[model samples]
Target: MMFRRTAFTVGLLALASSMYSHAEKVEWSQGSGQSDGIVVSDGANNNARTAYLSISSAISVPAIKKTQEEVSTLKRELAEVQRNAEEMKRQLSTQQNQAASGLKDSSANLSKEIDDLKRENQSLKSALDDVKRQQSQTASSGSSNSSNVSREMDGLKRSVEELSRENDKLSSSNDRLSQRLNDMDRSLSSLESKVK
Candidate 1:
């Protein structure tokens, strides 16, 4: 019985091999003018054991082309957006640097002016003290010279008041510039976060 089973299996394999050898792949044209199909046929029979496989029907060429075009356009749009973002970043950096430079220069100038004003104020105060000492020493001489000393003292007081007012104005300006710098920093940070 084992020998008979082996002989039957060998016969079946031989038949399969013969059929496989006789199989032919032919191009099948469609009546609707579509793409050609592959028809695997057995040469032993014209109508038996035929397989029709249409690759174009399974995958539409026009759909594939449209998808490819859409992907290309999307890539181009993404690249353009990236370029615009980079340009905006560069401009923002330039503006930030320029603003910082201007602020530094203005702050330096204001500081120098304040220092100069303080020194001048100190000099004026010293001169007024000297005049007071002179007035005290010569008070025994006359009333007219005392009046002149008082007028000089009054003029020095007015000058001191004016310098104080100007110093206050510069301090206020420096405060405003500092506030602007803080605001710009916050804005730049927010923009950088959004870009990331």
Candidate 2:
């Protein structure tokens, strides 16, 4: 649109210049027609048209310059916006990576906790088996010094019972930890969805 307007203005200026030149040529051709003949009126009209065309063309120059400046400013602003958006995307990517790292750390910690619990469970099972073996041996052997051994066996039985209780508690704790870890995973997935 601006191009077409500028072209039209230029065309008018060209036509005005042509008319002014033709008028000058006619004035030169007829010596008396130069100042005091019908050619004089024609020259006046051409000169006036040229003047108006120049003024209008002058007006269009500033408008064109302003339009170009505005375009350049808009281009600069668009570049700035693009730069800001890219920076924001970079920051977001960094934050997401940090969140993922935190999740991985939490998962690793949970896995370590699970492994520790499993080891504790195995230890308790082994202790229980040893206690059972001792009881079997004591029961099968009819020795004279059995009373003291039986009392000691009672202490071992109580220790085994306590270990069983602790194992049960650890199992329940592990289940809750597993559930919490799953919940954390779900929450992270939800957070990722919202970010996208």
Candidate 3:
């Protein structure tokens, strides 16, 4: 996934650079009131008169009619394009809103999951502490009156060792859970960047 994202970004950058390099710079001539902007041509060919027209006076009517029709067609196409653009904008906005809503929901869920995990961790810690306290009380009480102090010390030591083992197991499990959560976060972030 990471490799794919990197490749895509590289490809897009290369395409953008190529497009920029290939772009043409159009420089218009300064000539004004002309064909492409030239004014006074007393010859047969001029911007104002077409080759097909018989009389110069006929120029205005046919040309004007044609211009009006072209304008009408262009206006219709423009309206259609504008309507499509508006529809696209609306769709984009709706999709963005949905994405935001989904993000918010996921964030809330992640926060809740973290909180729940923390609460469970605290509960486990409290339970472990209580067990240690109970063991200490039991060992101390028996040691005060018993002749087998060595055996009591050995038992206490064994209990402490067992508690240490439990703590190590819990720690490893927590570490694994944390790594899994980090991996999930990375995946989600990668997905979000791609969507953008």
Candidate 4:
């Protein structure tokens, strides 16, 4: 009889240990209310025992509330960060579009100016060629005619020299503009990389 009692006590202790371990995994009830009961039976004597386990002490209301508040605060912070990122994206897009538009306008204006200069240069060359032909034809006619032709040729030469200087200046301006455009492009690329 003593041996049977000892074996029953060991089985009860093992069952209680298993129940305790499982109860630890259970979600804490919001309210500290009642102690849960479990019944155990010893097969030999056909007797039953009741075990009561209290889980209310393990539930911490203040800790749970603090954790919830922290989560809410983190969520708000994350939302604010997202909003800021979107605003930055929008601003960057606007800046890039404005820069591109300005670049296109400047390039178009430069192209038109270069075209106009080329046309003017061609016209001046044609005029100078005509003057040369007339001078050659009248060379043997007289000294007065030759002198007039010489003066006209000198004027044409001076005009040609001025056009050459103007063309050189325009070329230099075009090179500088191209360099500025390259610099702007690199700056935009750097900005984009930093954003990414």
TM-score of each: 0.54, 0.63, 0.48, 0.53
* 1-196: candidate 1 lDDT, tens digit per residue: 5566556655654565565675554334453444554334455566545333344444467988999999999999999999999999998887766666665666566556656655665665666566556555555556677678678667656765665666566556656655665665566566455544
**On residues 1-196, what C-alpha lDDT tens digit does candidate 4 reach at each position?**
5566556666765777675553422232322354542343333444433464443344557888999999999999999999999999899887866766675666566566656656765665666567566656556456676667688767766765675676566567656666665665666566555545
The parts of candidate 1 lying over 4 Å away from their true place are 1-35, 38-55, 140-196
* Model 2 Cα lDDT, one tens digit per residue, 1-196: 6677668766865665575665533321222423211222255345422133222333456778999999999999999999999999999888987787787789779878988988888888888889888877877787688788889779888987988898899889889888878877887786577567
For candidate 1, which ten residues in a row score worst on lDDT?
50-59
lDDT top scorer: 2
lDDT of 4 at 148: 77
TM-score of 4: 0.53
Clashing pairs in 1: none
User: What's the CA error at residue 187 for candidate 4, in Å?
Assistant: 9.2
The total of clashing pairs for model 4 equals 0
lDDT of 1 at 97: 66
Error of 2 at 125 (Å): 0.9
**Which tens-of-lDDT digit does each residue in 1-196 have in candidate 3?**
5566556655654554454443332222324433332112223232232111112232356778999999999999999999999999888777766775675566566656666666766766676677678667766675565657666657767766776676666666666666666765666575566557
lDDT of all predictions? 0.61, 0.71, 0.59, 0.62
RMSD to native, candidate 4: 10.4
